[model samples]
Target: MTQALPPLLDDDQAAFISGGVSISAAACRSGGLPSMARATGCRIAADRRSITILLSATASAGLIDDVRRNGAIAVVFSLPADHRTLQFKGGDARVVPLEPGDEALAERYVDAFAGGLEPLGYPTQVIRCVLACRPDDLTAISFTPSAAFLQTPGPDAGNALRSGA
Candidate 1:
């Protein structure tokens, strides 16, 4: 059986996701071709069973197509301040239509992302362009994580959080 994520994401995890940390999503083709793209923001489902990522279709055209063609995906969220990271692997990935206010979500994400980068000495304009996107072309990709692993720096990285196959 698949072990579900905790009933609620912990404070650190929640902050990392909502704080506009760097987001990267990847999907593979049945033939093993793979693609990836940067994501603007992430929303965890109410039930904590899934994650919805804000991706610009213009930027992730190949990754979006791969997810539609193959339902498996891997998303990694990392904080720019620290290398703290987490990866969620799922099998039910999909390219769903963006809901009404998702545009604002992306906007806030870009703002936060730029803020995060600024402290690290990156130019503001460069950071904004790194995640620029239009709502009309955005899509929400949701996935239920079938597995979770520790990806923090040090010896425990890659350790499984639960006992499962």
Candidate 2:
């Protein structure tokens, strides 16, 4: 018999739901994107009132590049609750690249996520802005969320915002 997974903490509650799978290590491939139907699980933690994401990957170099160019990335995983899948929409954040054996790298991720960040045992090549996008574009499956979370406005918000009500 398989051991039961623990209940999802509040941090894990806000995940990207694609079809029914949760985006986790098992769902993501080494050098490719996860299926849209697969749920990508990630922790969106707050630090000093700023939100950051915690991603686990065998190799994130390609993934980081994908996020930088596309402004978004998809993570797939299976949820333990009902054995269904889900995906979490990760919005773009700052990317910080590091060299191998950099002890300070983990600290940066931890600082980003606020709560303690756990090491995934994978060598990180680069960190890119994590962006939020819809899951309806997944190859195997097509579904859309009722709503989407856009990137946070920067200082340019004043110039971008419209005055009409």
Candidate 3:
């Protein structure tokens, strides 16, 4: 029985996460060791409860396996220029196949990510190379955020995020 979780992200937070922020995820492997991976992109459901994060299958195999095993996941989104960051934790993660339009979404994410970095002195080509992935190697992890935190550096870094809008 899967109960629908209320969305933790408001409209503004949704928009921020949808943008080309840096995304990474972590899950625990056997013995509680952590597996981490860089996510290529993400999609927020219309209901604002479930968020699907795209990962490179080859690069994220360990993380994917951990998610499959434990269903516990934590993902972070951060803007390179401002250091604004958010962390979302969930205990109901699931690994799934990428839908048809996800490839385009990943490409757009890569473009926006590169644009965000170009102003910060990172070459666009270099940024693209760093996030490059094959379409066939793409996988998705979907989870409903049960907890949200402010991870940006400073006094309130680890505080629970209440509202941004």
Top-lDDT structure, candidate number: 3
TM-score of each: 0.87, 0.31, 0.92
lDDT by residue for model 2 (1-165), tens: 011322122223343321222243212334766422211222232321112233333234445445445444433334333343333233332344322423333333323322212143322222122312223211111111111222223443223111111
Alpha-carbon runs more than 4 Å astray in model 1: 1-11, 163-165
lDDT of 3 by residue, 59-164 (tens): 9998989898889999999999999999988888999777889999999999999999998997889779878999988889999887889999999898987522
TM-score-wise, the better of 2 and 3 is 3
Ranking by TM-score: 3, 1, 2
What root-mean-square deviation over C-alphas does model 1 reach? 2.4
Question: Against the true structure, candidate 2 has what lDDT?
Answer: 0.29
Model 3: residue 104 alpha-carbon error in angstroms? 0.2
lDDT, candidate 1, 1-165, per-residue tens: 445435334556656676768889989888777899999888876666668999888889999888888798888888778888787788889987777778998998898888888989979798798788876778789887776666778898887664223
RMSD of 3: 2.9
Q: So what's the TM-score on candidate 2?
A: 0.31
The most accurate candidate by TM-score is 3
TM-score of 3: 0.92
